[model samples]
Target: MDKSVDLQHYYLELSPEPVRFDAVSQLTNVFFDDAKQQVFAVRSGGATGIVVKSATDGQNISFCMEDRGTIRSIKFSADNQVLAVQRNDTSVEFVPFNANNQPNVPEMLTHQGKNIIYGFVWVQERQVALISKAGVEIFQLNFEKRTLKSVKSLNITVNWFSFCPTSNFALLSSNMGTILTPVILKASTITKLPRLELGTSQGCSGRDVTLAQLYGTNAIMILRQLQNRQFEVVIYLLNGPGLAPKKSHILRLGQSGRFAMNIVDDVVVVHHQASATSMLFDIALGGAETEVGSGAVIHQPIIPAKTIKPYTLEVPSMSLDGKTINCDLYSQHWVLFQPNIVIDAKLGCLWHVLLKLNSLCALITDRFRLVEFLLQRTEGKPVLLNVLKEMMSVNYSGTMLPVIESIFNKLNCLYKSVLDNELQSQMALMALSTKSQSSKLSPVPRVIVDQSDAYTGVFSSITDTEQLGKILLLYLHSLARNGITANPELSKQIVIDLVRNKQFDTLHQLLKYSALNESKPLACFLLSLSNSDPSISQMALDMLARLNANEIILEVLLEKGQVVEALRIAKQMPGADSLPARKYLEAAYKTKDPLVFHSVYNFFQAKNVRLRGSPDFLKHEQCTEYVQYYQTLISTQCL
Candidate 1:
């Protein structure tokens, strides 16, 4: 039986209908702000302008930017408060924004001769960077005065400034993509004054190539399509702290077809047109030497032996021998299949490759097959858990819950299969023993029994509750280890099972190893179940104390009026001593509790006397306040 659950809940269709201005109109650029739920697009040909629309409903908003010249690019400010529009006539315009999708100010324009603005971007809140044939110029926009002032300019003939999506760094590729300079705006001044020759794409010319880089790092990746349609993703690590590119990699993706690349941190994802499959690459500094499987190195840069370690995840994949592919950190034992690569969980990498894979575009069948292959592997649990962790880490728009549940179901089925096989073996052994013993006895009628009957008898005879508890505990631990906290239903169900079977010890053990944040739901559910049982309550409290859950511990202790216990827990916590003193003082004041007053006063008096002349005495501000207050209390009582 196909045990796959209905995945319709995770299905989401983002059908963005294309808008046709005329037969010759073409989409120039597109941008999406998930925060604002808006989509911005630039088109040219029959109509040259920008269009803003709702990302969800695809409804066009009132704001529009239309002109006769070619709309080169449409960029949103870093703050998304304004839109910067550039034209081929070297004229730049800023349209101030309003809350109601209305144009709030008159269009502010700026020009730098007739060189034609190659590209312009809103680098900062009030600053814009414009690239023209002459050089790169930075301007500050004054929304109040409706004008732009030139703040800074780099006088190098600029090709394009490839801005990092997440940071202020832009790869300034000028002199026709030969010289690459990484420039970042720092408090209105550009930092990192060095530039290097990266050279142009070997077989591609003029805007056919794509460049990608990240903020806070100097690694620049260039993706180019060859004349034969073969695509290459080249990583260039430069001009950063002990950072250097390992080698360029030729990808199997987009073989004789086009491909698109996206870089997030050290990982790069490529969506290929030929196979329609997504390939993930972990870009790092120094890695183990491996054969450049399918990729040939264009240039090899010698790097130091011991440098900043590269964050790499080992996948079951191979590279061509004696090539640029470095196998520095990944283990050699994990085997890579022709189309599938097995990833080992023990590989000391950031597991970000899994994260990148989640966002990469691929066919649904490919994703399903990938998950199935991992689940069937020997080290499937950890690898699948890592996948789950990546899914939990990001707010992905794709279907993930079904995949997670499918993993869970497969694990359960495996456990069940093992149990069934064991039961069947035990039944067969028992039946043979019975036949041998009954041979000497009277021959009973050979009554036929159904297979179901024998299986039921075997199951009923099983009494290994401990083994069952261990299995359940393993399943629960697997879920908790993977940070599956969003599924409160599953968590609650498991807690109920544990509590019903009086398995407090196993529950405690499971909670002990789990992360504080990830174990919250199970811990909370355990507490709720402990209301009627003293032993269960104590176990839960002990687990919470070991978890260092200061907030809940303090709340429980105070509610129980266990002042000494609460004091101990509080003292064990950082900067919590003052809490118990304040609480006891408040109790003394509110209820005229003489016992509480004396206890708090006496403790403070001893602490004050012990540290009276020491330098550390003044540091205990809470102790000082309590000492004075207690002294006043005693004096007033004496009067």
Candidate 2:
């Protein structure tokens, strides 16, 4: 059963371009430019054919160059018009390309360095950076002037570095990758953030540190060996300026030999070469040991560590056409880039890692945590709805009730947060548009699971009204805590169920506290339940009373033969004399109680006198018929 769940939950899908290898140079000539999502094959320093291809967009750009010793780092401008090549320690060579593959005059751009240039990357269309033992230097290339101008440079001793193109962010490591400095590299500006010093317990190696965006925040995921000698991926989120970057998570890869990582759908997927399997962790899980200031450490994988989904690669075959063959799931030569890009230069293939959320539904036994994790995904709502619907479809036995309750709590918690934030944002925007003293801008809000979404999608189809009533009440009680309006149809069902179970006091308190959605139709529904328990009618009457819906209140009172109560309410209205109290008198007449009939008559008679100074009915007044009935009742009683 576990294997069945693992079969489809996570895997790697092939990107468009899998075969970008040069048969002549094989794996030896190729290098990946992650910033452009392109792979380049430099044949003999480009004296032979040079080729560039992208797995992302099927982009291919090729040019030739006279042998420039060994190309260390290479990248092309955004427009593919200028190529920056690093062949030596002192400087980077910028060669402009005109039209298709023709070279212009090459320009040498050197950086201020006590040390040589280690590697470089193109920050923007014409901006590039050179990192060395000394520091990082960002420079701009002016094609028109044929010059390389210095932009901004940071002076700090660096051992190695990693870059995330998504935010134009970089992490420079020194003191053996334990001391880290974060900086934002823009086309014209470099915002260097505060330096972070890793604790001594964590390893001091520089090779294992990688920078990437996880959950939309630029963070460093370092594969470190702890003091206990166990390997863990220690992640530190680099927050905005003035806020110190903090260590947020620790993903334990027990007995790790060599592990690589990728962030997919905000989940951290760690691939271990020795085990030939991958383990996934969602920090949102808030692991058992989420101790404050110690960073949350996830002791176990979400699902047992499993190999990547099986895939077939196409290669030349003995048949007339190429045939697909099973590819190794976790190859030693496989290279992983941030946010789900994987490449195996030796196999001449690139496969993108993906998480199949639909299959994940089964492996996540803790339903509440499943929902909380899904709430953060881009394509999660429909999946969440489907999962919730399945949970609702179960027989709703007592054992599963706690699990369902937990799921509801998670959904409502997220819903209330999203709703409150959106309302605040809207209010702020309105204030800003008018330029009022209250002008303020709220943080943008994100969508999440809400109450109505659950009802309409999951609970509405419930056939067992009894079970549904209990479940609905549970969900509604959770929603009530969040201050969200409960669904009326659901409220009606709950009231009926409560009445059936003889939970009148609970029902009364819920109505009195306004826990259920209050509406005239709901009040009437409660009136129907009065046959089971008379107090239920009073519940309905009280609900109407709170609304000041005197008309409906009078109908309910008279219908129940509570003539005196009905008359009292009619008298309390603003236009008490104009109130039509004839129904109250008629109801009293029907009761055959002469005293009740006579009291009702006197009240109307007094009202008539106050309105027109006549005890008898006026031409416009409609009380003559009631008066006759009252007199008949009195005579009948005397006889």
Top-scoring candidate (lDDT): 2
Give a tens-digit lDDT track for model 1, residues 564-639: 5666666677765345455554544444555565665565445546656432234434446555655677788842
Please, what is the whole-model Cα lDDT of each candidate in the order they appear? 0.48, 0.75
TM-score, per-candidate, Cα-based: 0.42, 0.80
Going through the candidates in the order shown, the clash numbers are 9, 1
Top-TM-score structure, candidate number: 2
RMSD of 2: 5.3
Residue 415's C-alpha lDDT in candidate 2?
74
Per-residue lDDT tens digits for candidate 2, residues 1-639, read 476755566543445436456633442577788887888877773364578888777878777778757777788888888888777777677887878666675554434445877788778888888777888888887766756787888888988888888888888887876688888887777788888887555535556877788767788888877668778887888767866688888888886588888888788888888888888888767777864667556546887887777777778788888798787768776888877888887777766787777777877888878887787777888888888777767544667789888887777876777677778777776677564645333333233666556656675555344455566667778898777788787677667657766767667767776878999999988888789987888888889888777889988888878889877777777876666665566788787877778888788788668777878876565667776776676677753
Indicate the residue-level lDDT of 386 in model 1.
46
Tell how far residue 105 is off in model 1, in angstroms. 7.4
